[model samples]
Target chain A: MSVINDLLGGFATALSLANLMYALIGCVLGTAIGVLPGIGPVAGVALLIPVTLNLEPTSAIIMLAAIFYGTQYGGTITSVLLNTPGESASAITTIDGYAMTKKGRAGAALTIAAYGSFVGGTAATVGLVVAAKPLGSLGLAVGPPEFFSMMVLGLALLVCLAGDSMTKALISGVIGLMIAMVGIDPVEGAPRFTFGNEFLLDGVSFVAVIVGLFGLSEILNTGTERPGKVETPGFRALLPNRTEFRRSNPAVARGTVVGFLLGLIPGMTGSVSALLSYGAEKRFSKYRDELGSGAIEGVAGPESANNAHANGALVPLFTLGIPASPTIAVLMGAFLQQGLTPGPSLFVDHSELAWGIIASLFIGNVILVILNVPLVRVWTSILSIPPAVLTALILVFMVVGSYTINFAAFDVFVMTLFGLVGLGLRKLDIPLAPLVLTLVLGPLMESKLRESLEISQGDFSIFASRPICVVLLLIALVIAATPLLRPRRRKTRSKENQHEAA
Target chain B: MHEQNQAAPPDRPSPPAGPGPTGPPGPAASSALAPLIGQAVLALVAAYVVFTSFGLGLWSHIGPGPGFFPLVLGVAMLLLALSWFVQERRRTATPAAAPAQGAATATEVPEVPVIPGIPSTPAAGTGDGSGGRGHVLAVVGSLIVLGLLIDLLGFQLTMFAFLLFHLKRQNAVRWITAVIISAVGSVGTFVLFGAGLGVQLPAAGIPFLANLGL
Candidate 1:
């Protein structure tokens, strides 16, 4: 099959010494970001974009993409040892993960989690390889109308699935669009919201905004709490027993399936995939009752799903040029920065680059397993870092990161302003994911909508006239309507959660 | 509002448990109408956008001009923010909805594996959780100063002071430890990124400082 040959070609490109080193470095830094508090992958990757300015596009993306997936495995460490889920997908793991820590089986739980993430990521990469060609072809067939509709669906889904209130999420998305409109009118040469500042010409630096939004805001939010040093206890058993392995295998399989499938959908977040994977384990695992306790299956299933979901989310980005999550949107921003638009045309125009990145993903996953297993002690030691010291260092990095973007002090100011904005949004529980995705997609969506209208001579009927556009729009409509129709589910779920907490 | 000031624990019970504050705060007087303030502000922004779009040009025979998309977004924002206001007003009327509204924001505390980030990470702290406002103000103030002074004092000296302030002032870190860390972070980072990677962090602006090779 041509797929085999193309993949082989991809391996040849990926096997280059420079590409391998980049992958190794990406996985390492990605794990650090995951383990380190305050810097999320969105900000971490965004922070590093300036550093990659000198590299070839393929190597740059390969490294950034590795950081993206590397976070998946890194979050599990805190979930198990510190009773802190480094990320949301790892949140479920904290139940059994911490329980295992309590039972002094922390090492086994961590090992299983790492292995599960590897299996899930590897499996999902296979899915991407198999599905990318067909999906890219399908994406190529879409016209401007359909493309516009597809973006609508993505945004609608993002808003619907974002937060407790769809209204807040919608507001966040709209704000993102507004922010995106701040620079020059990409269509016309006139500036809209710049207020006549030269720095506003390129729009707010994406790197500055992102670092401020995700990174600095976090520092402010947790600034008060001085995390006292906690000693990491030594591990009892480093690897799972035979029974633990047997129990984990099926959950890994189930998590991979759930994560990959959910990842393929428009609005599914890693948290959703992990949550659903947890639900599946509860329903089907023979040891389901032990889920809340120190059960390896609990640690394995969701971590696997979380990592798989991460890689699966890439399918949409690679094939359709649509970022499935906020993190992916940031990655897409990186792609744009590299002067490479991610979409079907990428495959045709730069198959070697595309496949090279794909091959690097699998390599990244392997490097993660190899590196993380031996580095667990080092990773755990990161948690022992004083919050004050860590905060200071992170702040310096953020400052340097923003300054290096265009060597502009204006960007540091922008980062500070958005940091305050980020704090306010978090305080109000406004979802940032929708804001991020909309921000990244705004220009493209605007351009596509304008092009479609141009083709139709300003007639709006073209959107409805096309079957794919109609169906995509309908799907968007349905997703938007879900909360309105099932208001009780939303209320009950929140209430139930509140009651359980109480 | 003060109740909301108390940050949420790292882990909270939810349909899918997430980390972060669940909502705004408790029903302070039940009619605590803070959400409305945000909605009103957003509505005003939307209105401004709509007003400004007319100047940029709207739809044309050749199709959408630059303003058309922003116009649509601005109008949609206006309507949506208004809807949010209405929703909040209705919830304010319902006493039971008050508490739920404050807690309903916990959908995912949203740690979507997409970006395994730091959110609600202080639950492990054994210290008394207090006095965040000062720390936040200090951080913000210092960051602004960094931005303003980086071009003048240069990256190394500015970062040295910034890191020194954070390390010493925040936790009463030992003066020796603080200086060592700050020096390494500033001078060391400058060497790694500026010299090695050729990132070109700002050199001192003053003639004397530049001559000193700062």
Candidate 2:
């Protein structure tokens, strides 16, 4: 009852004209960028963070969160219409989505995707409201040792799940941590890696690094690529037919449940969840035989899963201050920039803001469905703009956005340096998510470790002594060792079974 | 079996097949060398980090100093890089067997199985490799110019020049289109961010542009 009343109060705050306007703007802008190939929500949010510098914290966060989910909705348009995923998470949709377009059912495929996204997003938001409070309360009882161990678990999960190569991910993560340590040490105020520069005192700007890596690197890579021919099919009907709706109903339900559960796990992002859902649907759907040949369920399931996974990602950020994905990691940077720390205390200290943002997510979903369904034609036109113009505009925005961080040209130079580095990393197939995640969490881990050591008089056993710390460390160990152990175990089992059969 | 059939179809355009931007796909030989070079760079960086940490004092009377964390990280990074180097060398040594098998099957299928969620296609016009490098240099060079000249020419002029150059050099836009885009993008962003959003942009530094305010 209290949760319901608080949500109602949140609605009152979110309904204000100012907040509503920001939500609308975020939704529109998020869709615009999300429609563009090669630019995902991470760069979209990073580019807009400077623009929100003047807004109040609550409104700023509400707008940013809206953009996050709005991009998920927008990604589907390109996947279905052009067979090109607007974001990586939308990749699964291209199989059946593009097939549907080929069969003259693009409108139906898109409409089902929008509806499924709404259902998934709304359900996950409800789960976040129900789960966040209990999780936050649990976090409030954790000490520094436990917190450090938790961060270790988070990093382990990221490296383990990041890509095919664990070593590359670890190297990327270490580089990010090293970058985080470049400025002055938090405890002793001693400079570590600044190399005698004044800007080194404040550390590398998160905005500068992100915009360079995601925004600028993307432009450089895409600028030389040949543009594909995008065919904009005329819309016949906006809603799915009755048969099509019924076929996708169960897939939407299953995707919502699967995506929400997977999303709660640290380091499991929307891309992973959507991929898993697509795999599950391929096995379980009644139309499985036709899945890759324009089945509506294929479009419905992965689209819902991606959106639900995005909403599910917010739970950890709100409760324990741990970001579950790269987008959330960048959002955490935004929180820190606003002079607010995310964690259990945020709920108690700024409950209104927390609840208001949650409430705005609910409103944001309705706006996304309406915008994606009715206004999708407008978004498709964005695809027709010359890639040259788009690339140039993105570069200009990257420069302006990084410059606004400190009004320093040096930051732009730093951004350019990282842009080249990012280009190199991308070519090598190194996942950027783990790097971004560790960069945000590295300082927190360091500070917590120091505090734990201080409490135990410099004894290393303090990390193992606490019950929560022990469990978290154990989890991290198991996560890291699982990949190494699996192949060996399978080989051993196969040999023993062959011996028994012989 | 059905799932495998759906997931592993050879004719389907793999997730990475499209020419949308994310860099040109380099040849397999170059890709093999990339990780080797990357690990080497990582090793060097680790060494520098370890060398620098000694000045910050690893341990203090209270607990650990600022250097303690970075030192630990530096050592771990070094070990990881070493392992990566060893693994890459082993893989490279065994590549002959795989290439023989791959070449045997090469004519049966033209497209490789796409790795889900990773772009696989090489950029158009980059198959020869030289064009791709030139594109990269052009973009990076423009960024350098923009960074160096932003303060001297002011935000609008610097952006205008950067856009115009990139559009002409890399994108091959017509002269008129490039000019129109450069003007609209630079001037429009200036008004939107400066006047509307209240960001303080650098004023024109050139004497002639400054005097033109009259």
Across A1-502, the per-residue lDDT of candidate 2 in tens digits comes to: 8889889889988999999989998999888877877678888888889988888998889888888888889989989988877776777899899999898888899999999999999999999999978999998988888888888888898788775567777888898899899898988889878889998789998889988877777655555344366666556666678999999999999889888998887777777777788888988999999988999989999999988988998998899998888888888999998888888988899999989999999999999988888777899888777666777778888888898899888989888888888777766656677888888998888899998998898999997778888888898999998878864785698789999999
Residues B1-214, model 1: lDDT tens digits: 1001111212222221112256544443322444566777888898999999998899766888878888999999999988987876676456455545445243234343444543443322111344266767998999998999999999889999999998888665789999999999998898888666677778899989988877
lDDT for B168 in candidate 1 is 80
True contacts kept of each: 0.43, 0.34
What candidate 1 gets wrong by more than 4 Å, as runs, is: A224-236, A488-502, B1-33, B102-131
A162: Cα error in model 2, Å: 1.1
lDDT of each residue in A30-75, candidate 1, tens digit only: 8988776456777888888887777899999999999888887888
lDDT score at residue A66, model 2, on the 0-100 scale? 85
- Tell me candidate 2's fraction of native contacts, as a decimal between 0 and 1: 0.34
Going through the candidates in order, what is the number of backbone clashes in each?
Answer: 1, 1
When summed lDDT is taken over every stretch of 10 residues in candidate 2 chain A, the lowest stretch is A219-228
